[model samples]
Structures are given as C-alpha cells and as structure tokens.
Target: MSAEKKPAPKVEPLRKTRPCPECGKPSQREHYPFCSNRCRELDLSRWLSGSYAIPVAGDEAMADGEDEN
Candidate 1:
C-alpha cells in the first residue's frame, strides 16, 4: 500500500488591503491595521495614554450632572 500527502488548502483574506492608521502605509498581515511593529506600538501608546478619546456633547455632559435649576 502507498500513502500520499494532501496539499494544504488555499486561504483567502476577508478584506482588501488598507492603509495603516499611524503612517498611512499599506497594512501588513503581521501587524494587521498597522504596517509594522513601530506603527502598532505608537497606536497602542496613544490608546494607553488617553490620547484617543470620544467627544461628548454638551447635553450628554449636562445629563451626567444634576440640573442647576
């Protein structure tokens, strides 16, 4: 009896190539949305340091506090 090995199946990417958020370079598979480790780290640092934040509207801010009236 002879044994044969099967070839691996080809995999497809879910999405098309996109620019890195940090430096506007083509994103890499290793670093995903970022092109390289440096870009990835820079984005991480921004997140960790509170540099990226969602702005709140005046109404939302007032709702969080008691009404002065």
Candidate 2:
C-alpha cells in the first residue's frame, strides 16, 4: 500500500503597516509605534475627552440627587 504525504503547514506573510489609525496617513519612520505624532496625540485626546466613556452605577450622592428630582 502507498502512503499519502501530508501537505506542509501554511505560513502567514509578513505585512508592513501603512496607515495611521487616527488620520489615515502613510506611516513614517519617526513614528515607529504609530504612523505619526498626530495619531498618538489624537489617541490621547480621545482618552482625555471622554471618547471612551463607561457606564457605572450611581453613588449615594447621585442617587439622592435623582430621588430629589
């Protein structure tokens, strides 16, 4: 009986990141982690501006205020 040979495992190709997530510009060498300083700052601005808000249960003071109203 002839033995069947299994195919080699598939490998993913290496890709270079091109665009800045914040502004969609081609990445530059100065910004190793990010495409540019603007993108980095934009991310920070989003955090500082409450762009990623999370809901939480009201505390005693907040509950009291709501109850009064």
Candidate 3:
C-alpha cells in the first residue's frame, strides 16, 4: 500500500456584505438588509412604478418578424 495522503476539502466563502441598498445600514436576513418590511415594500414600490424596466421590442417590430416581410 502507498503512503500518499489526500488533501482536505475546500470550504466555501461567507456571503458578501453591504449596507442596505435602501437605508444605508447593515443588512440582516429577516429584513434582508432593508431593516424592515416597510423598507422592503418601499423598494418594491420603486420597481413597480417604472423606476426599473427591462426593454422589449415594440408591437410593430414583433408583428413584422412574424410575417418575415
């Protein structure tokens, strides 16, 4: 039998930390870095209010593609 030894398994790094994107305070899991549900909701409201958007092709462009014209 050989005397070679296997190396230990590698461990994963801890989560990245940052101040709450909303309140600029330390983040926690329960409130998820926002401090509270109220803050979380406030952040969500901004997203829903067209403050954040993903671009999509206009209806006319899509129609032309379908017909290959």
Candidate 4:
C-alpha cells in the first residue's frame, strides 16, 4: 500500500502590535490601543470625566461675553 501525505496548511502571521496608550504595554487585538479591559475602561473613564479636552480658537472678545462692532 502507498501512503499519501497531505499538503501543509498555510499559517497566518500575527498583526503588528503597538504600545498601549494607558499602561505602555503591548496592545492586544481585542483591546486595540489598550492592553486589557481595565486599561480600556480607564481611558474611557477619563474621557467621560472630562479629563481630556480639545482646544478651540476664536475671538477673545466673543469668548469673554462681549459685543463686536
């Protein structure tokens, strides 16, 4: 009897990883920018608690509740 060998399956390489923004640890696929759920939640909490803010630029007089002519 002759033995037949099957072809090997293709192996997919893991995607590149970056350091977590919260803890500086290796990030995971599930958590993405964060390493774990805790880190992800912490980041979200910061956003929700107004720890992070975006700067805006406009007229200083208008911002000071003044009228312009």
Candidate 5:
C-alpha cells in the first residue's frame, strides 16, 4: 500500500501591520504597534511620568464640591 501526504492548512494573522506610534516604523509581531522594545518602554515611561493627561472642562459646581439635587 502507498502512503499519501496531506498539505498543511493556511493560517491568518489576528492583527495587521501598521506604522509604530513612537518611531513611525513598521511594527513587529512580537512588539506589536511598536517597532522595538525601546520604543514601547519610552511610551510607558511617558504615561507613568504624567507626561500625558486627559483634558477636562472647568466646571465650577464640581470644583466647589456642590452636588446638584
């Protein structure tokens, strides 16, 4: 009897490649969104150091701790 070999199945990626936010370079699968470990760490450092912040509108009532009943 002769033995037959089967072809391997095709695989697809979960994410598409895009430019890295830190360096604008093509991102790698291992690093994801970032081109390298250095870029990733730099972004994290900025976040932890409060370099990035979310802006909020100045509401007088909230600032004075007054609740609207």
Candidate 6:
C-alpha cells in the first residue's frame, strides 16, 4: 500500500478585519477585531471607565415626565 500525503487545508479568515481600536495592527482570530489581549483589555477598560458611550436621541427630562404619566 502506498502512503499518500495530503495538502494542508486552507484557513479562510472568519471576518474581514479593520485596524485594532488601540493599535493599528490587523486583527487576529483569537483576539478578533483587536490584535492582542492588551488591545482588547484596553478597549474594555475604556468602556468600563466610560470613555465609550452610546448617545440617546431623547431628552432625559421628557422621558422622566412620560414615565410619571
């Protein structure tokens, strides 16, 4: 019996990556859109520290008034 050697399987990227939020490096599969753990942690830190936030379109005073009604 002859032994056949198979070619290595190709690994396609799971997602199209943009630059890392903390660094300019391309993303890795493990860390994803960030290049490394440090970048990921930095992003988390920013979020936890309130450096990142979502903007709401309504006034808080109006929302509070509506809630009472």
The most accurate candidate by TM-score is 5
lDDT by residue for model 4 (1-69), tens? 998999989775676899999989999988887899999999999999999998768977798999886
Candidate with more favorable, higher lDDT: 4 or 5: 5
CA-only RMSD, every prediction: 4.2, 7.8, 6.3, 7.6, 5.3, 5.4
lDDT of 6 by residue, 19-41 (tens): 98788999887898899999999
Per-residue C-alpha lDDT of model 1 across residues 1-69, encoded as one tens digit per residue: 998989989886766679999889999888888899999999999999999999876787477886768
lDDT comparing candidate 6 with the true structure: 0.86
lDDT of 2 at 35: 85
lDDT of each: 0.88, 0.75, 0.76, 0.90, 0.90, 0.86
Clashes of each: 0, 0, 1, 0, 0, 0
Output the worst ten-in-a-row residue range by lDDT, candidate 3: 10-19
TM-score of each: 0.65, 0.42, 0.50, 0.64, 0.68, 0.63
Error of 6 at 52 (Å): 1.0
Return the candidate ranking by lDDT, descending: 5, 4, 1, 6, 3, 2
Candidate 6 residue 66 C-alpha distance from true site, Å: 3.9
Q: What digit string (tens of lDDT, one per residue) describes model 2 on residues 10-60?
A: 875545867777777777666744687878888889999999788777687
Q: How close is candidate 4 to the true structure, as a TM-score?
A: 0.64
- For candidate 2, give the lDDT: 0.75
On lDDT, the leading prediction is 5
Tell me how far the alpha carbon of residue 33 in candidate 1 is from the true structure, in angstroms, after superposition: 0.7
